[model samples]
Target: MNHDTSSEQYILVTGSGQVLAVSDTAQSLIPHISPLLPDLINGAGEDTVLLNGRTYQIHRHLLKSESGESYGLLISLQQTSAVQSSDPRLGAIALALSDKLEINHVLENVVRFAMDLLNADAGALPIYDPDTDRLLPGHLVNLPVDLIVPVIGQRRGLMWQIVHQGSSILIADYADHPAALPELVQVGVRSLLATPIIYGKTPLGILAMYRLRNEPFSESDRELLQAIARQTAIALQNARLYQRAIRNADERFALYQASIEIGATLDLEQLYQVIYRATTRLVSHQRFVIAIPTENRMVEYVHIVTPTGRQAPQQVPLHCGLAGYVLRFGVSLRLSGAQALPEPAVQLLPEIEGELADGSLLAAPLIVGDRIIGALLVWSNHHDAYTMADLNALELLAATVAVALHNAFRFAQIQSQAITDNLTGLANRRHFLQVLHQEMERNRRYHTPVSIAMIDVDHFKQINDTFGHIAGDYVLREIARRCRQQLRDVDVLARYGGEEFGLILPETTYEQALKATERLRTVLATTPIMIDGRQINPTISIGVASFHPTVYPDPSSLIADADRALYLAKQQGRNRVCGVQELTNDAQP
Candidate 1:
């Protein structure tokens, strides 16, 4: 066969690795290729050979004599200035990619590099949506308007075709192409090229370049674009993986914080606050509501926190609204734009009329075991503001909230039971003493007066003898209820023992306590305890003692003084009130 060795460099080598012939340009590269002769002979197609710090593209061909008998191997060399220019930018991009840990930053850098490398009028890097099988525009440069690529039944656009076929595509007459977008044509795009950004066999996205001039992309341009796409795919994939790792770490930290902060307190209000603070870190919202289910299959808004303040909680029937939907179905709902919500859901949530006008809603069910306890609802004032990632985060946060709320409720119930009297539904003796001690300490610090009252039924034994013990129990309950009515909300009332009661009135003077006890004495005397159609009038003797730093230094001393006054009240007359000083003088020898 004939050969052209003048314009291009060529080398002929015998099978034994002896140089039989050489072109003028080949002589300079012979030294570099000789040391790697075995590798050059074994390697097929084009291989890069570096000679004296310069890169050369080498191609190998088999030389033959007549009758197809192989005589030797032929090699050619071409200098790589095009590749050299791209090397620096590619290296810079690699450095940029390695420096960035954020996915968005990496994507922006890729789009900028691609645009500058191609010198196109505009460019875009659209990420592949695996679920939709379409490209969602990620980063764009100098685009007049937003571009929305479409995916038809069997005819995805040129972009999808390039990804589907795993090849680079160049459309010189893009305006006339079948898969060209109308927007692309209107924007004066005459030529375009799209290269699939791929990681192994999986396609990540596409890097597309657009030119307003009617010029066809050459084979070299396609190759360069493919090279850029490959680099971008690796960088993008690395950034995505890194970001995913970071998100996972953040989520784990948030859950750990939730476990510690939410579980730190048994108070329901404090638990709600902790959940609010923790969830705000994951997602931003203006309104947060926790809806708990009632025994009657109804859902009640147990907690509602808003930017302004808290709102009064209200209840609705099951399956009535969005929150009800989550509670009834035990699933999550993320709705963006008012149009996304059904007519029935809108009508059910009339209270949130202002928020629904132009807001996005994310709701998730709070489930513990098989029981669906409540639902978490968060609302934002922007349309389509929440993503699937945000919904997933809310679900995770809802889990932590559910466990904490359940524990807090149980703790509250246990606390209530511990300090309450079973019969009269009043504070027990232990609770009274605890409160008295605390109140005395507080009074000492603030230099405020605290009063205590000791009361006994005037004729409790006679009432039990006359009526049955059941009636006596009824009388005691009635008396406790009346006493509670006369005391302030801050006052502490306890069932001291059988037929007796104790009261700790904080911020009260001696005279105020006496007058309050007198009112209780009169009320009990006037009110009759009715049992089985029998009216039995009951009265109570009362004693009052006010805190004096010198005289009543502690809770026990105050109680003792009040007891002395109570004996005086019994001695003087039943259904009366007496102070500690009055009792001391009356007992003077």
Candidate 2:
């Protein structure tokens, strides 16, 4: 294909390495490049070619689209002098740096490569950790690794000057320089040359070379180091991209499994634990919490876990901390350093014990439809301890949590309809049976006592006949409510049938069950339920049966024992409590 060769030499090829277009200058050298195309496409950099007895350097330039798609390749040629352009080792250094994918390995190799390029006795390339906003002295060649890495913000240093001036520093004798560390001088460092390694606007670190002998570095040495610095920047950036891609793949797989786990869990507390565990896989965090908004403009901490264990959950004002802030406004927050965080979030987290405010905190809102239900928060006790990738992972998990929470609430509503009495708001007979069987099984394992009480209203047919079924229905609902108020929370109360209620008092002895039943009879007989401008007194009789080690074989046999006691109570006197041994206690009717 024909191309614009008037301005410069350019040979454009398709992404598949096939020659597609050529500039006018490139047309004359087509035959020379045909053989080298395969190697050039496979990451080969530059080569020399003889055209008309004159030497030229042909560099491979990868042409990429705006979205980073490999659009094509451009082979550009330029005349090269006999003296050669820059050091040939720079190409080998770049190739070596690019060959490694691990970021730490790439950085370590870059330090040794820098020393080889500048011919220095020692070299150091300290990488910047964004989380701590500090340089880490991880990679060094013959230099002490314990030295605190110099940064641009730390004034009165050689790195600061190099970073600010955007030029290299060549020191002939570094024995008494103010910017030089006394420790370096004591370690036999006499000469030094340094340049900043930057990728775009971000300063990665300073590439420093040290010499034991006092040999001055020339301008050519500085130029060579700068060229290698540029190559180092490209290699570091590419390595980071490769590492990030790998982390993202692992995160996506983890999140996919999290979605399924969260969705299947009907228990809200279990779901919270699942979500918190899932988040730990995707982000580095010392603490994780789930908070929801309470009715009184307060944020309730339902789930809070730290490195030690769970922190006591409590409620705080809506403007108290980051969780409330994220839940209120439905926004994600990544907080670290002095960069402005909201006033309320910056406030010390007194409510969340063992959480330090000095570190970083990231929060994301759990939203379902247009409403923000709650927030998920992760905290680290170090400055700049989180990244954008961590926040993104949190947001994704929040979305999964939101959907799961919504489904759980909906499922609960439907399940309630299946197992709840509409009139009394108590467990229906079916649910009661299930609970009974479960409690019996638990007692078998724990060897705990179990007692069941059955109650029936006396003369209920007469009241329904006189006051109509509506009045009877109202009194039955009131009885259910009163029983629920008096019983322990562990007691399972249910509507057994019309005018009948069943109560399972687990972990209770025979005497304790009888006393509770007696109390129930007193409550119904002593207090008059006001209804329709009339005080209606509805008394009741109760029967108590304790599970025996040998007598009662199962839940069905236990129910039969309780029913026998109920018949005995009715025969002795209504408004009385009776047990399986025919022990009766009378209540004033």
Best by TM-score: 2
Worst 10 residues of 2 by lDDT: 580-589
RMSD to native for every prediction?
Answer: 14.3, 8.1
Provide the overall lDDT of each model, using Cα atoms, as 2-decimal numbers. 0.77, 0.77
* Tens-digit lDDT string for candidate 1 (67-174): 999889988776554233445676666556555546678678877887687777778887875633556677777775456633423535677677789888888898
Cα lDDT tens digits, model 2, 229-296, are 77666566556655665676688899999988888888877887898889888888888889989779
Clashing residue pairs in candidate 1 (N, C-alpha, C atoms within 3 angstroms): none
Clashes of each: 0, 2
Clashes of 2: 2
